[model samples]
Target: MPRLLLVDDEPSQLKALQRTLRGLCPDLHMDLALGGEEALTHLRARAHDAILADLRMPGMDGLTLLGQAARWQPLAVPMLLTGVADFATAQRALNETGIFRYLTKPWEPELLRAHVCAALAEFQHRVTQQTQAAAWQAEQGVLSPQELERLRLEREEPGLTHVEWADDGAVLMPALDAHLPSMPR
Candidate 1:
């Protein structure tokens, strides 16, 4: 099950969000925090797949909390929800903290659910890739500089490269051409 953390300073707003999320996504494990500090506490206790925090708060605004989250839980997806539709703040959140999404107050339940699901899926993909890379490193000892560069390129531009794994654990990159040599028959 995907775990999520919701942060809002207002008690009523936080409770309402929790209620709506529970009704919309009963299977999701959700936690509510009254403020950024409380949210940080929850984040420290366990790993959450996604975090949605209101932009404005009394202490440690959403952006600040998100920056901390970025360092602490780099894999977790962070989202900003605020009543104020400030583009500057949104840009800062995206550029500095890498927020997954910026949602305004009074968000549509369905849309919110969709975004959260997408973020969770992305977080899962990142976690899976990290685990696979770690396992490969352990099995193959240390990777060569060229191999590491290839892996990085594959991740950055997945469509630009086609990778094949040979029986002896060799990575093969074939040119994108119809007349390319075929495997021996």
Candidate 2:
């Protein structure tokens, strides 16, 4: 199940939204926060897949919360599901907060569901990529000098010949491709 954090000041709005989206994302685990401060508290409580936040709120607005969230959990997909979507507000949110999505007020249920799914997919992809990168780094730690040199050579010359002088060419392959003859003058 995808864990979600929703931040808003209005209790009624929060409840309605939760109800509506709950039906939308049956597999989603949703949590509520009354304001940005509460949202941060919830964030610190546990790791969540995504965050949906309002732009306007009392004490530590969504943008501030997003900035802090990024610092704490860089992989978490934080989105601005706000009513306010003016040019300046959008610009500020995109530039300053690193928002993944900006969903305007009175958004469609289907659209909301779509966005949530996309965000969750992106979240999963990021986690997978991070895991793979970490594994590669760990494996690299066990490599011998010869293996490291082979990797460097493969990177530097995609189709390097194993033959004669190139200063110190790491022999990536035992023999160069026989298909391509040496260049004609």
Candidate 3:
């Protein structure tokens, strides 16, 4: 069962989420946070598989909390729960927060559960890819000095570095550090 952290400023919202998700995802262990501060506290205390947060809140808005939380646990999937119907807010949620999903208010349990399932599935897929890639690298040859340098550069500017490394037909996301065998000096 995946652990889920729910953060919202409103008690009513918290109650709503609890009631909505109770029978929907019985297998999930839900942790409650009244605000961003409390949410960060819980996030540090335990490792939750996913987080659901309200967009509009006092003291550390959802975007900032999500960004900071990403640094804390790069793998913790985030989903934003908000009633804001504005397109700009949705765009910001995607670009700034990197949210897995922006769930509108009056959520259907099934839909929320579906997003949870999808988020977990995506995380699992990435973990699997990283593990497999690591094993493959271990079984293969070492990275040359030039390749190592390329990686170092990629760590700096991922987008441009990826293009620089694209000729080798290897591409990766920012999170996973792919291993390349050491090239002969």
Candidate 4:
């Protein structure tokens, strides 16, 4: 079962959402917070698979809270809900904060449930990938200094093609001689 946190300043709105989500997602363990501060408190106590927050609030807004949540719990998927449909705010939330979804107010219960389920699935996928990568790293011991340097260079220069090490530890790369810019030959 996935854990979720929902934050809103309005008590009535929070209660309504809570009741609806609980009915829709009976398997999900949901927690409600009155404001951003209380949300942060709940976040610090335990990790949640997803967080849904209202964009407008008194002290700490949803965007700010999401940012904090990202730093505190990178695995958790963050989402924003706002009454107004502001493109600029939505863009910022998607680009800067990496919000999973931006939902407008008066949301349909089914749509909200679908978005929450998708976010939970995504979070689970990420966690599984991280675990697999860690296991692979453990099986394959640390890379050589030369290989590490090559990897660093490859990351720095996106134009470079992929490179792999052979069984004998030889570096192999695609033939880029013909693709190179013409020289004054």
Per-prediction TM-score to the true structure, in the order listed: 0.72, 0.73, 0.70, 0.74
lDDT string for model 4 (55-128, tens) is 99999999999998886677789999999988999999998889999999999988998998899999889777
> Which ten contiguous residues of candidate 1 have the minimum total lDDT?
154-163
CA lDDT of 160 in candidate 4? 40
lDDT of 3 by residue, 8-54 (tens): 99998998887777755447788898888888777666666788999
Lowest lDDT sum, 10 consecutive residues, model 3, at 174-183
Per residue, candidate 1 scores C-alpha lDDT tens digits across 1-185 of 67899999999998888876775554788999888878877775667888999999998999999888775577789999999988888888889998989999898988887888889898889878875885688578777766666656544433234446899999875445422323578
- Best first by lDDT, ranked: 4, 1, 2, 3
lDDT of 2 by residue, 1-185 (tens): 67888889989878867877776655788999888877766665566788888888988888889888776566679899677678888888889977889888887878887887888899889878865765586587865666556544533332231334455765334244332333669
Which 10 residues in a row give candidate 2 its minimum summed lDDT? 154-163
Q: Residue 3 deviation, candidate 3, in Å? A: 0.8
**Model 3 scores what on Cα lDDT?**
0.74
Model 2 TM-score relative to the real fold: 0.73
